[model samples]
Target: MSEFQKVVLSREITGVPVAQDFAIEAMARPEIAEGELLVKNAFLSLDPYIGSRLKGRHMSGPAPKIGELIPGLAVGEVLESRAAGFAPGDHVVGESGWRTHCVMDAAAAQKVDAAIQPLSLHLGVCGMPGLTAWASAHHLAKVREGDRVLVSSATGPVGGTVGQLARIKGATKVVGLAGSDTKCRTVEREYGFDLCINYKDADWTDQLAAALPDGITVYHDNVGGDVLDAALANLADYGRVILCGLISQYNLPEGERPAGPNPGVYILKRAQLSGLVVYDYMAEQADYAARAFEWIESGDLRYVEDRAEGLAATPELFAKLMHGDNVGKTVVALGNG
Candidate 1:
């Protein structure tokens, strides 16, 4: 009870993360201040965003210092609370980082229903990823009936949710572009995407053209660089593009970044481009979670997750993710809660 463990950055990540870049250490359990809650994390979400955060390439905030805890989203139970509107034993989701225990500001947390089976879902479909999909659906894109929607990185939690929601909204076709063949199959069979293309294939763009003969009406882009460029080339007359994440070059240091997709393509396609910053929609999270919860319960919306055990497993899990090898949302079980 007197000590806890944390995964820290052992060295600066110059490119994609590797297992050696992280090290876990034990530290003294600390007291919580007023307006803070002490939490015991049961599951940690290892997302692609963490890869950019580790390299200080993301816009979220300053990066963690060397030997500091790496950034992560966690679902856990409250061990003690000094904040209003919260009590001990309540389940909460927050930026608890990669740790067995943490004392975080109450304002950073969203209380989740304990009845929701598998607390890890709070970190995946029902948590930030779900909220991202909802916000993009309601505030950004207009998913018209019979429209063709193409989603990049489609097998992951956010992409799968986005594509499925588009499907529910009456989009005639929901296509996905993933890194591997197995992922493509999973998206088509499990997530209900109309078609899933493995972009790793040399003729993938040709396949996308053949699959959607009319061109894509909406492009929900996650990976950038060439993927964005290619998607733009096949865009319909008036496509709406959502720029979510640019994981393609997220790891590159400042000067090494590419020039990115062409502006002419957007102009030629009359593409309506809107960038998605999830924090902008934070105030409406509860309401959206309620709706997403229902869709999940009713089987209208679906998700997949890949889980690993223990905090020590995070580095390896995350490394695999950055290498584009993991299927679905990747989570690490702490086995503490």
Candidate 2:
């Protein structure tokens, strides 16, 4: 292709994102240098963390600047390659951002077997979000059989996957906290969680307490603000809290972000709280992918995608995601199969 479209950060978002915050511009295809591969991105992921990046703050490295391509993960096909192991037609997954095409070095792109799962799955359940769920549930939380697990933002990809994996690992009960009653039903009926509470309801905290009468043993926190505070209040003695994404606070001004769970709760309950960053487990990606695929194939795990067609739709999709409008993993489809 002679030209392609990319989404660039147009302005800093002080609150919720809107179309004015992003610009879709046409650009000449990048020239591939030796040892680099040119990839045609098929699907770009829309995640809550991207919201924090848009505001020039993140837990990771430097934040994306205005006029920069919005940072994201995508699954694509190699169209041209001077890289040693990559070849034309190879499917790969990488940090390609919100663009139709990008040039990536060999070390940055990892080949994926489309035959094992759909290419878009690489950007969701089988990709970074999936790995984040795995690392949080297995490593940080150390979820065990008979544990009473509670997950916040339970309708999103990471929380949904964590709940399912916890159940598969033999957790006696897995409860979820979602934004709406519909989402709560979907989390319980479709994702197989034992129970789900609608956090939007006025009595949701009471509902949470009723759901976890024995207290929560494992808390997979995704929307870490008021929900996290509620989890802390109900934490069992020696309970484990896996700190995942803090979506509820991502779009807020720094000073307006809610005070997080009380530190005194940790001391009084003798609880353990650990932060999780999926990239820290890069060395175990292959193992995580294998096991995720196995669970998916065996009907033990189910995943959903809220997909938008075309690269231009990403900005709106991302805004909706930040406002809790998506039901599962959100992805933008950019290429034909």
Candidate 3:
């Protein structure tokens, strides 16, 4: 066994995350057993999903058991293996959370072609983000040709792909909502969104309505609260909304559920809203990935990333994402290579 440096969760937390809450410390190496492999992490994901863990309502499983290292997803290289079909240097993606190293069973990790895209993308576009966009558009939103589609967090991994998928599905218009003017410009000029609006503007709702005069028929929602309310107000009759995430409320206190959806338009429009978790559709992620790859290769799909320097910056980068400070998938790179 050897002592290695890793980050651990802290006992205290304020409204926003602090570096102290995620302390880096030295720890002994984990022992390997049958069907298990030792991994050296290469890239760790910093996403809004982790904000839920800090609030103690993690939603994945029981509240993370306390004092554990903060939970997340990562990509790593195999260092030692007692597993079949896996050898040293093979890269894998798994729920190894925020750590420098891990010992995970082979069944829990999936082999990845890290050479095709950066390992960080295993947690972003080619991974959960890609799957989320595909399923929400084709399955939950039920988009059709000529439908008017709207996507929030336009440049974020999930919402960015949603707009592209809608366009590829023959949507007549794709309106994207982002936090900054720069992101708004990129979504429209670079990602091919028909219209883009900065949600931070006081008149954003009005601009959104003007962008889709016929009304929003499908909304792939990554942001909730005010944005959700505004979407509700602008939806067409029988419109479909895929409730992908509620990043707005992830940092709230324990036992404090965010307010319920506004009902006026929901009742009048008779809209159809569905909530989804990517894990629920794990059986089909591979199929979705294949489709995304095809679209990407054909120039119908695009992606962006906000790559940070080191594991030590993960906590701050996560906070920036929650505060709408990042333009795309936020990642923390750990290795020099």
Best candidate, lDDT-wise? 1
Worst 10 contiguous positions by lDDT, candidate 3: 1-10
Q: Predictions ranked by TM-score, top down?
A: 1, 2, 3
At residue 13, what lDDT does model 3 achieve? 68
RMSD of each: 1.5, 1.7, 2.3
Model 3, 72-154: lDDT tens per residue? 77888999999998899999878777777888789978787755466776777778887888789888887789899999988
lDDT of each: 0.86, 0.86, 0.81
Ranked by lDDT, the better of candidates 1 and 3 is 1
TM-scores for the candidates: 0.96, 0.95, 0.92
Query: Which of candidates 2 and 3 is the stronger one according to TM-score?
Result: 2
How many pairs of residues in model 3 come into backbone collision?
Answer: 0
Checking candidate 2 for backbone clashes, the offending pairs are none
- Could you say which candidate leads in TM-score? 1
Q: Which ten residues in a row are the worst by lDDT in model 1?
A: 253-262
- Per-residue lDDT for 1-337 in model 2, tens only? 2359899989877688887889898888889999899999888888888788776677544666788888888888899999898889999888788999988887888888877567888877778888999998888888888899999988888889999999988899999999898888889888999999998899999988999999999999887778888999999999999988788778888567566655788999899989888889987876788889999999888888899999878888988887788899899988564
Candidate 2 Cα errors over 4 Å, as ranges: 1-3, 254-258
